[model samples]
Target: MNDRLGRLRDTTINLAHGSGGRAMRELIEDVFVMAFDNPALAALEDQAVFPLADLVRHGDRLAFTTDSYVVDPLFFPGGDIGTLAVSGTVNDLAMSGAKPLFLSCGMVIEEGLAVDILRRVAASMQRVAIEAGVSIVTGDTKVVERGCADKLFVNTAGVGVVPAGVSISARRAQAGDVVIVNGFLGDHGTAILVARQQLALQSDIESDCAPLASLVAAMLDTREDIHCMRDATRGGVATVLNEFALSSGVAIRIHEAALPIREEVKGACEILGLDPLYLANEGKLVAVVPAHAAERVLAAMHAHPAGRHAGVIGEVVAQPAGIVVLHTGFGGQRIVDMLVGEQLPRIC
Candidate 1:
């Protein structure tokens, strides 16, 4: 039985591991199954089945989201592609005020990749899943020819339950609503740039990749009137604000002084000729809420470890609809336009 089951040794990945034969099964069992162990996945079936009653008890609607991670450096200062994949998906579901439940992972590995590296990535996914109170119930794996793909890529799809009577959307923002950001911006992008070591610069910046489910839940618990919540991702906080303005037909006005940025990240962006506002961040989120509830929600966010740096940076307005403007610290106001082109690609 042991011989028939095959084994995944501390060696490099080959094409046969994805062949759907005994090797493939062994790879799944040894790496993925061992790390993401749960009753649903332990079954080793093609699909995962859930109890309908349990799902219904959480909410009436289901929030489904999918994201693909192709970060250039597989590993960076604070996280890897595996950690980003899980956090990204969980944050997506949390954006809708949903309680994230299950996830599906898909891995595309290049031939000759180290088996130990795959193990490390799988372990990362498992750790993040356990921290977020979610499960990896189903998944698929594939291997590509050498040079056809990067060292590793991960794709995650997640589903969550949106509690009854909780409605959060970009279009829900209205005039007088306050804008709040959870923490520092541009950390992830700057960290990746520094990790590349292409520029001879030194700074202590780390990717802010983290699951935001708990933070979101805390905000919801304080009040269900959250107008909108979105993780500042690929295009950073600037892109998210523009999305909200366009979606709600409202203008957003932000104060430059209120924007939160790490000193290291700020210096790096200055040297790189980039704007921290346009840089990507993994763990931060932007939320819009009624002025009356802003203080309470901000207090709630401050209590959460992920949002200890929460700050109110902007407000929604009625004039100049579909636009975002930044009130400069220099007593000037300028349009915060949507990113014209990719500032930095593959940072995510």
Candidate 2:
């Protein structure tokens, strides 16, 4: 029976897998259990159980997060809505410096949606959960009338535990603190635009829809002086930085050169008249650290596989509290304002 699905990557997935039969068992064993070979997951119980963590001294510090994915086309160049669902929820929990523990997935399917397509999406979601070291302990599935829903929609809720002394939030940025980003910006938005086929450009721009818990965990392990952390998802880096500036009562100036924008993404932005700085990113994050801990934190981030291209892009400075400006390469300064309207909708 297992030979039919032999080695996973080939069989793809069919609706039979979710029908409570041998196909169902094979799907879980071959993809979920196989990829995530851990005692915690191997139990195959209805729910996952684990200690919250000894460091959560104040109380049961559980960081909860949830996100819904209805990305058009469901499937894209680098990932599908399935991958986006898991990564988005997990990344949010991790942004609080918490280690992801368990997840619950809710799937809504249009009546006419292909079962095969649904299987493929489920398989992709399982793979993402395994890699993130979190479990889909519980889930719900519902079928919607045709044309009433957008192909398929996935909602994932995640919980994680934050270690002692690791407190991070949007308002944690402070004056004289350094702002560092995990990697290049706007890769996800540009990639989505290309995949949507609305615009044509010469390049293979892939979405950066990936899990970043490991990178965040590494940073926390090395330093606790980390003031804040946030994944720049829907609103892009510009919004993420602007929120901090207002919350911390400081102004920020980012060097255009220091901000990493892939040449392809930059080209795409120029071609479409889009600003990469204002575009969305799924796999990137911003961290605010005390000036003294900046180098150490950056070093730890750069050492991680996901943060290899980490950069100290800017810093928080005293100002009128709600301004974010950028220094352009052509010897000019520009006000990098937040989006006045929805420039790019359904981004995440």
Candidate 3:
């Protein structure tokens, strides 16, 4: 019995595990608990019960965010959709000055998907959630008919608490404020393109799908001068800047020279006729800070493991109109418009 079950443990999660029987308990203990060990999670309950603390005790503000991941190829250069789901949601709350505490995951698997692939995805999600200091409190799973669903799709919703004296948003940008990005641009998007488009480019571009909750907390701790924080996800920097501009009723002018475009990414974009500004990034962010605190903020960003390539990509301006303008490297400017057509569909 041990050997037969041991083989099951070594293999993938079968339908029996989702059947809510002994197979399910064995699967959870062998995989999920082993990968994400925590006292809260060890309870083995459907819903985790814990207290959300606050300094003032007046039900301090909290941040909640949810995102779905459907990256093709399942696995990519740097990370997979499972990890991307956890990181993406955690980073969203972090950007809002929140300390992520818990997460709920949902898996949509194709009926004929491989069990090993499912295990790999689940393990990746567990590892990332643990590393981010967040717990996967609960999750649901569903299997769709082969052609009706992709190989896999993961959705994650995170809950975080924001303490007093810390408020950040897209509407906080003001004139004379400096905009900073956590790292080089276009790596994640181009990496996916390389994988999905089957490009022959061989520069080893990697996806930057990493959790940034701790890094965000570090920035807020070191300085209170940060005006706003946002990750460069879909629609990329162009979209983020436009959001800030519209929310704050201000105009933003980005410096093309200061933009962080890696050599490999530049090469790939040139080859594919793509623009880096509109490219999506999973592990990068745009931080708007006062001009006076720019140096310190940039320094702090550089000190973090995830922010070594931080750059001051743009600035907030009062142009009597709310818009995002891009200054070309050739000394001209153009409106960085929101995406009209799908550039890369299903790119989470």
Ranking by lDDT: 1, 3, 2
Q: Per-residue lDDT tens digits of candidate 3, residues 1-348?
A: 242233244354345656666666665655555556676656667777776443235227877889988888788899988889989999998898888888987777676667678778778888888789888877766656658777788899998888678878788899999889988898888989988865677768989899998788778867556888899999888888888998999999998999989999988888878899889999988999998888877778789999898878888988855788888889998998777687787778
Number of clashing residue pairs in every model? 0, 0, 0
Q: Per-candidate TM vs. native?
A: 0.98, 0.85, 0.91
Query: Candidate 3 at residue 131, lDDT?
Result: 84
Give the number of the best model, judged by TM-score: 1
Q: Please provide, for model 2 over 7-90, each residue's C-alpha lDDT reduced to its tens digit, 9 standing for 90 to 100.
A: 434343345545656655565556555544565555656666765454255234789899998888788888999889889999
Residue pairs whose backbone atoms clash in candidate 3: none
Task: Give the whole-model CA lDDT for all candidates, comma-separated.
Answer: 0.91, 0.79, 0.81
Model 3 spans > 4 angstroms off: 1-30, 54-59
Which residue pairs collide, candidate 1?
none
Off by over 4 Å in 2: 1-60
The global Cα lDDT (0 to 1) of model 3 is 0.81
lDDT: worst 10-residue window of model 2: 1-10
For model 1, residues 1-348, the per-residue Cα lDDT tens digits are 243355676488889988888778888888998899997886778899998788899899999999999997989999998899999999999999999999999999999999899999999999999889899999988999999999888999999999998999999989999999999999999989988985468877889999999999999998649998999999999999999999999999999999999888888887889999999999999999999998999899999999999999999999899999999999999999988899887987
